[model samples]
Target chain A: MGPLFPQEIIGEELNILIGFFIGIGFGFLLEAAGFTNTRKLAGVFYGYDFVVLKVFFSAAITSAIGLFIMNQYGIIDMSAIFYPKTFWIPTLVGGLIMAFGFIIGGFCPGTSMCAAVTGKIDAMVFIGGALIGVFFYAYTYEPLWKELRDSGAMGKVNIAEWMGIDSGLFILILTLIAASAFYAVTIIQKKVTAKGDYQI
Target chain B: MERSKKYMNPYLAGILIGVFMIAAYYFSGEGLGASGALKSVVVATTDMVAHDYATEHSYFSARVSDPENPPIKTWLVFEVLGVLVGAIISAAFAGRLKLETIKGPNVTTKTRFITAAIGGLLFGIGSQLGRGCTSGMVMSGMGVLSLSGFIGLMAIFGGGYVLAYFFRKLWI
Candidate 1:
């Protein structure tokens, strides 16, 4: 009944058009939330501003809950949605690499695009760096990363099922944790930035 | 001219983003992704430049073999283009569109720009290896309770915390 493109409820052109609109909304929100500010983005790790944490956790929980409720009501086919397959070793190592990138750069791929479009010169440099990295990987694919890339093939697995819990219950618990995190971080932000004068 | 404007409330912005993410799933049967779009762009461009080599290489082969399903004709690519448009609009409305480098007072613009480039390069390589970035693998995966998403979340956030201190000069 849903997933218009997959179901042919919408044509290819319209489907992509919708994607374009949605992407714009996503990008707009990222910039509007101060994600364009490198200092604000990096503050998550420094215990200063918690906007990144708050927004990320809240958005995650909100989507989780919304999807669960929709699935329970059969509004969307939860089973058909594209879920990423787990490759534990690569993801762990890759994530670590990305983490370093985040702290040093103060933006991820998505946020960097946001900042770049909004006139952040630093983000422009970051994009150049990303292009170079992509080219490097492409050139050295056979020798450097091909093997490690395909290692630890676990296929697609759901965490809720792996943890032996109902999906709904897991969503609820995650929501609670996020709410608690928001509360804790608000206090931490106050304490950390109280007199620092790290004005944006 | 007006001073740079204030940002939106994080919670409210998060909700709007969350709704869009959900809508994306329902419409396309897919999650939000940014890096994949870039990868597609890279693949398409490379294929065009070196058709024989592109078809021969393992990385570009899968995308190139399917003549009907070119990488450039993908949903994420269009979505990303929209992201640029949307971001520009929002920046314009807020009077935040200015040509400047976002950095800390402690760091020179040159230093900040260099580090940002290096960071972006690493992220680009890592995303290819990991099969996704924060939005694709972590956030979208988590929406459906995928274990990989949790792993990505842990690795990226954990990794950031571990490295943040060493990179403090670049930021604070």
Candidate 2:
């Protein structure tokens, strides 16, 4: 019933247009939440600011719960959407690499775009780096990455399934975990900012 | 004129972002992504400059739809473009729009830029190898409760924690 574009519920051109509008809203919230600020983003790792952690975890849980409920109510066909296959090894390795990038570079690709728009010089540099990285990966993909990329192919296994538990229970546990993390970070933020006149 | 404005409450912002992600899935049958859009740009550029080479290349060829139509004409690209505009508007409203380099107090601007570039390059390569970035892989993957998402979450966040000390000078 939903997923207007992929399901052909809406015209192709209109779907793209909708994508544009939705992207704008997504970007706006990212920036308004101070995602463009490298320091704020960095704070998640450092315990000075927990905004990134709070925002990221909350969003994921919210979406998960919403989708689950929507699917249950028959409002949307969750199966029709493109649920990415679980390539565990590559994803783990890749995520580790990206994490290193985030710590060193202080911006993810999406946040960097937001930062770049607001005239952050570092964000621009990150953009250049991303392009170079893309080119590098592209050129060496077949030789260096192709095999590893296909490793650990656990084809579309949900986390709940893998854990041998109910999705609702998993989500509830996740939500509780997220809430605790948010609370812990708030405490850490107070402690971290207490000793110094840090201007974040 | 005044000091920078405070950002939106993190929880509120998270819920808003969550709603957006849901909207993305509902309307487009996809979730939000930033890196995949960038990949399309890279592929399109490479194809435009070196058509024969692009066709021969494994990655480009894998995703190439029409040989004539540009690879950049995809959903993520337009979505990313909107992200830029939206971020700008938000910044303007908040008065946080400034031209500055962000880094740790000890880190030099030159060092920051260099690291930013290197980090970005690493992220770009990793996203392709891993098949998504934080937004695309980690966030969206988590939404569907895919094991890939959790693995990615651990990798990126856990990896960051592991590497943070080494790069402490960059952000601390």
Candidate 3:
């Protein structure tokens, strides 16, 4: 009864429009959270700020819990939604590369877009670089990336299933971990910024 | 100069974003994404410039083969357009719209730009290989407890922590 578009309860045009509005909310919240600032993003690694960790974990947990509840209430069909397949090898390798990108560029893809639109010269350059990278991969696809990209074809799997734990229990454990991490980071940030040498 | 307004609380903002994620899933059966739009743009550009070449290449051809609907007409593309609009509006309201390079005081602007470009380049390649970037793969995937999302999240954050020491001058 849910996932309006998938169930044909909504038409394609309206679906795309919904996507636009959702993107607006996404971008607005990102900026409001200071994600447009590279310092705030990089602070997670440097311990000067834990905004990224706090925002990321809370958001993930919120969505997870909300989706679970919605599915439980029959308001949404979790099975019909688009979930990413687990290709462990490429995801791990690519994720490592992205980590370097985050530290070096000080922004991820979404955040960079937000920053770019908000008049960040560095973000503009980053976008250019991303485009060039896309082109590079596209041209060299057959020779370089096709095989690796397709490797490690594990079908759509979730952590709860893989760990042989109940979904509710996994969510609870994750929330506890995030809560503890949040406390720890607050302490760490106080210590690091107490030096007063670093300013964002 | 007027000081920029303080940012909203991170936790509150996260909840808002989470709610939006839920809305996205409920309405469109998809989640948030950024790089996917760029992929569409690239495919569309290649198809426009070299119709035959694009069709011949597996990467571009696979995407552009649907002649009836261009790649730019995708849901992610429209969503990205909205992201740009929303960001601009938010920045304007906060009076934070200014052309500048964000970097550590220790690093020169040139170095920052160079590193950002290189980093973005790497991210682009990685997203293609990884099937998505932070938004598409990690955040949205985590929403549904996808295993790849957790794997990607650990790799990105853990790897960042490991390499953060070496790249200290860049951020700190």
Candidate 4:
């Protein structure tokens, strides 16, 4: 009933417009949450600031719950969405590499774009690096990464299904976990800030 | 301008983003993405530079051979353009628009620039291999309880914790 574009309720032109508006909302929230600041993003790893964790977990849980409810009420059809297939091997290896990128670059792709627009010279350089990296991967795909990228193809698996739990129940459990982590991180942030040596 | 303006509460910001994600799914049947937009740009560039080669290479051909439209006429590309606009608007309102480099006090500006570039390079390649970055693969996947998303979440965060010690000087 929902997913207006896929359902043909919305035209291609309108779908692109919706994407633009959504991107605006996303960019605004990221900037408002101080995600454009490199130090704030990197702060999660250092324990001086847990904004990244708090924001990230809260957002994930919120969306998980929202989606679960929407699906139940028939507001949106989850099956029609573009779900990512589960390719464990490449995802794990690539995620590890991205983690290093996050630590060293102090920004992810989304945040880098936001920061670059906000006049962060370092972010601009990081973007240039990303372009170069994408080109390098494309060029070397056959010899270097083709096999690894295609390995471990588990198609569009759901985590809750894998865990043998109802989707709603999984959302409930995730919400609980996120709440506890939020409380824990506040204490950690207070303790870390009290040390006075580390400044964000 | 208030140079010291405080950021919006993170929890509030998170909720706002959550609502946006729902809107994204309801309308477009897909989640938000950043890296894919860049990938489109790469595909388009290659197609432009070497039409024959791009159509011949397995990697580039898979993306570039769409006869209906060019690779750059994609939703992510437009969304990313909107991202730039929204970010600039917010930065301007917050009085945070300044041309400068950010880094730890201990690190040299040159070192920060070099490391940041290298980090971006790795992320670029990794996102391609992994098929998505944090926003697309991890966060969007988590929303729908996708296994790939959970694994990505763990790997990225776990990997960060594992390698945080090595890059401690860069941020800490």
Report backbone clashes per prediction: 0, 0, 0, 0
Tens digit of lDDT per residue, candidate 4, span B1-172?
A: 2464788899998888888888888899888789998899999999998999999999989778887767898888888888888888888888888998888768999998999899999999999999999998998888778999999999999888888888888877
User: What are the Cα lDDT values of the candidates?
Assistant: 0.86, 0.88, 0.91, 0.88
Q: What's the C-alpha lDDT at position B6 in model 3?
A: 84
lDDT of 1: 0.86
Cα lDDT for residue B3, model 1?
80
Q: How would you encode candidate 1's per-residue C-alpha lDDT over A90-161 as one tens digit per residue?
A: 999899989988888788888888889889999989888887878788878889888998898888888988
Error of 3 at A195 (Å): 1.7
> Quick one: ranking by TM-score, best first?
3, 4, 2, 1
Model 4 misplaced stretches (Cα beyond 4 Å): none
Q: What is the DockQ of each candidate?
A: 0.78, 0.83, 0.83, 0.79
The residue-by-residue lDDT of candidate 3 on A68-145, one tens digit each, is 999999999999999999989999999998998888888888999999999999999999999988888888999999
lDDT of candidate 2 over A71-177, digit per residue (tens)? 88887788888698988889988888898899988999999999998989899999999999999999898999999999989898889989999999999999998
Total clashes in model 3, counting residue pairs 3 or more apart in sequence or in different chains: 0
| Native A-B interface contacts kept, per candidate | 0.82, 0.88, 0.84, 0.82
lDDT of 3 by residue, B29-93 (tens): 99889999889988999888899999998988777888667899988998898888888888888
Model 4, residue A112: displacement in angstroms? Answer: 0.1
- TM-score versus the correct structure, for each prediction: 0.97, 0.97, 0.98, 0.98
TM-score of chain B of each: 0.96, 0.95, 0.96, 0.96
